[model samples]
Target: MKEENLIVRSVTKKKYSSYAGEITPATPNLIQRNFKAEAPDKK
Candidate 1:
């Protein structure tokens, strides 16, 4: 039980950090660009 709690706490902290990192102003546009780039080639 104690080990599980520690693992959950560490995962939660990392998730929060990742969430904070993802909300930056540049994130959306970069994601959109990459998404477009990855689409099937129109040929």
Candidate 2:
């Protein structure tokens, strides 16, 4: 019988709000709530 070696890795998850803080002045939603598609090609 043979034994195999295993490796483990660790990762740190980042928060969306934390990343947004890096930017100066939050961006505005120019499109607003208008989600109507103009045309099939444009969409």
Best by lDDT: 2
Candidate 2 per-residue lDDT, tens place, 1-43, comes to: 1355655667879755645445578798876877778786553
TM-score, per-candidate, Cα-based: 0.12, 0.33
Could you tell me the TM-score of candidate 1?
0.12
Off by over 4 Å in 1: 6-43
Question: For each candidate, what is the lDDT?
Answer: 0.48, 0.66
Clashes of each: 0, 0
The per-prediction CA RMSD against the true structure, in angstroms, equals 12.3, 8.4
lDDT value for model 2: 0.66
Candidate 2, residue 4: CA error in Å?
35
Tens digits of per-residue lDDT, candidate 1, 1-43, equal: 7866654344444333434445555444534445454457732
Query: Which candidate leads in TM-score?
Result: 2
